[model samples]
Target: MTEDVPGVMMGFMENWQGLSGTWRVTLVVFVLVLMTAVTAFIVSRLVLWLERRFANTNNLWDDAFLHAVRKPAMGMVWLLGVYWAADAAYRYSEAEIFQANEHLLRLGFIWLLVWTLIGMIKQGEQLLSTPGKVQRPMDYTTVSAVSKLLRAVVIITAVLIFMQSLGYSISGVLAFGGVGGIAIGFAAKDLLANFFGGFIIHLDRPFKVGDWIRSPDRNIEGTVEHIGWRLTTIRTFDKRPLYVPNAAFTTIAVENPSRMSNRRISETIGIRYSDARQMAAVVAEIRTMLESHEAIDTSQTLIVNFLAFNASSLDIMIYAFTKTTEWVKFHEIKQDVLLRISQIVDSHGAEFAFPTSTLHVPDGIELSGLDQQGQTS
Candidate 1:
């Protein structure tokens, strides 16, 4: 038995030796790799099914986010599997190829992890915004702009961190960036200005979406639809889309008349100067017309003897505010008020003033001379 024990031990050592090399480790790694791939495929299928079923039966937005995240999630799962396999095959370090492959897998896993986290952040953004939080007047544009900016920041930060993790000297990179940043800044000055302008718009609540804005330099009357990085898109009342630079909005005077709770209507009507003695009567008539108008805000009504004479007419100005914020309603009210004033003047025996030239003969030439005048008398 003692002699046979040595042979038996030798046989066991031979078997152990066969399984101890890089080949055996490689085979094991391969099996693990295959298992991970299959697991990922199954998980991916499950995720897709869950996404579709949940989307159709419940939250559609989360489904969209899941769809966007699907590939990234699968990549992460495969990466995790490879990482586990690499750890299991640690005894194969003698094979430089496998060692390098392990390092590559580790790096790949990190990359996939970053991508997955980014997808999660994007999905979270969508979920957070689905709760009717974006129902405010300008909230949709603001939230969209902010979401894009956040993603940009996230990408930049992730890239820099990954570079550092890859053993690149962060200080050297930062120093190089400092020099290059100036040139890049110069090239992207306008773009950066608009980016900051978006923040300014958020901080300083100006005209909201759907508010008509009139700039001083140009007739930019439109509804703000999107606030982007470099341009703010406005849909004009005529349905033309105007892409205005963000810088212009900061510098230009935007008259947001639509933001006002009510509209103002100012007008002037001229009466014949010959009937100037009925000035008080005319004023009373104008006041009555303004007071009775449903659209005009009576609190702001101002009836005045506006002017003495202009060419051939006496002009009276009637100023008032429309109780509506709509331009069409204000126009309609102004038209009705003007019509009422015209009818009032006609009723009071006062005519509308028009440009007239008076022609008179000389005093001595009147009535065919003084003799004819006395005889006719």
Candidate 2:
């Protein structure tokens, strides 16, 4: 074995000596770099071809994998080619040069691994962004939370690997991590609260992406666009996006008005107090209008009646349910009902009531008692 080792070393030395000029060294490095670049270009084209092929197949996972492979191709090519070139450079049997080359190779490989993992994570996120087959059983909030957690795990693993390559002991690193995590938790209590709040939002299923939610803490009504780890995004009716912290969401009463299958609309109309019969007719007309309305749900009974008496008018409250929960359609239905009821009341010679207050005074008192008249003592 010892004789074979010298023979092998001599052969290796001969190969190195044959290639030892400045120009040869430069040529070797250039050739390695060019080959790496060519390999990277080929990989990129191959990934593109695979992606196009997968696009034809109508399968998603393959497409995502292809997309992920394209990103790390260059890094991987450089990592492999550079390490091999570095190994080819050691002509002497000295230990120090070999150690330096080994360290550099490990560092480069670590970097490549980190970025490649990141690329894969990016692809995962893109894939998870699409709704699942079961009509998105998990809400966006939950998906986002889980995706972020997985990403964090990837980053932590890469960091640990990098540290290990740098000669860090596993136990010492874990102890340091435990202390660091505790310190981070203490310093970022509110941030941790927000993260937990995001978890609650996902688990509770109070509202979902595209839900029209109103916050009790703020007078804002909008559709949910995205639910993130720290904040939830809502796109308002006015087309403005609002970002509110997940913790704030837990603090407020979130009214998910869009969750209902149908919307119940109730309104009260009034007529002159002197016209009781006319008020009853108005109620009947309102009820008939609601009953015949195409947008109203016939499954539920519509109610319209003279509810009470005001000082100047008789109050009639009308209650009905719209067939749709869509805000635009509900508004249109309500507007049409109001117009039709108004026309019916007007044709019956009864008017909608405007609230008024009346006052009584002594008959002997006159306008002259007023400050401008100056006629009473």
Candidate 3:
């Protein structure tokens, strides 16, 4: 195939022998460009056709792979065309200008190929992160982190290949990089710590993107927006964005509320001392209410008791878990349960307590007041 290239060019030039040198080169360039354009058009159409065919299939991976490659493949086609044109137009010329141009085209093709591979890696991440598609779907944060690492690997490999193509000594470059890396590591120790923290997070699988996490040691409590190499972005309940260092997750005790099987509803409802007589009945009604509540998780522990006697009231405790971990739904379920409890207490003629005190004086001590005088009341 290599030997045939020159022969093909020679035969083409022979056909154009009647044209001057400048006109002959011009015509060759024009022909190569036109051929490249036509080839690229055909390739693109073929890809689109394949995409349409894949769309009808049950295999999700095939469709994802095709979608990932489509744009990159088109770019590659153009790159190949340019490389071919450069090669054909300068096949016989030994000029430095032509050689440099050919080199640049080759480099462009290499970089474009690398870009395509990186794009495919991104698509693979998306496929893995998609819920219900894979047997074991990865968390979005883990997927994003892994994708970043894969892209870095792709870029590093491409750079090495590019360096080698440019006639640089690979071993020497590696040695230099090793020494430089040590110094850079020391200089960016915090950055490296955050990076490793992210790596540990990926491995540990503590919390994932979109999970509601609260750090007891920190003021951060919200849904995870992104997990990057250096920082993790969280969107708070108040709609404020919080950028926290990845390393912070390593030291903090993070609570993943999203992973909870049930959301807790714990409260102490105090009733007036006068309602003490109805406490047993109130407790029984609340217990019944919790047991039959649709949103409450019956499988979990449910407690409704007249547990304590306060200074001026009877304390009734309610502790239960909701079936859902959703923030809104959990609150809704909790509110409904509380309302029903209030109604039950109201039906039992039991009033809720307020801070109150009553004082009494013995009959013998009451006679000390000034007789018929406003001096002391």
TM agreement with the true structure for every prediction = 0.69, 0.80, 0.86
**Model 2 clash pairs?**
none
Counting clashing residue pairs in each candidate, in order, gives 0, 0, 0
Off by over 4 Å in 2: 1-20, 90-100, 107-118, 128-139, 218-221, 236-241, 355-377
Mind giving the per-residue lDDT tens digits that candidate 3 earns over 62-168? 87777777776777767665655565566656556667664676578778778777878877898898876787887677778778988999899889988888889
For model 1, what is the error of residue 331's alpha carbon versus the real structure, in angstroms, after optimal superposition?
2.0
Candidate 3 local Cα displacement, residue 207, angstroms: 0.5
> Which candidate leads in lDDT?
3
Better of 1 and 3 by lDDT: 3
The reply for model 3, stretches above 4 Å from the true place, is 1-11, 14-18, 88-93, 105-109, 132-137, 361-377
lDDT of 2 by residue, 100-206 (tens): 76677777777666676666766766666666523345455566667777778877887788788789997899998899999999999889988888888888889
Which window of ten consecutive residues has the lowest lDDT sum in model 2?
Answer: 1-10
Kindly list the per-residue Cα lDDT of model 1 for residues 126-171, writing each as its tens digit.
Answer: 6555555334333545656566877787777767777776788889
Error of 3 at 184 (Å): 0.5
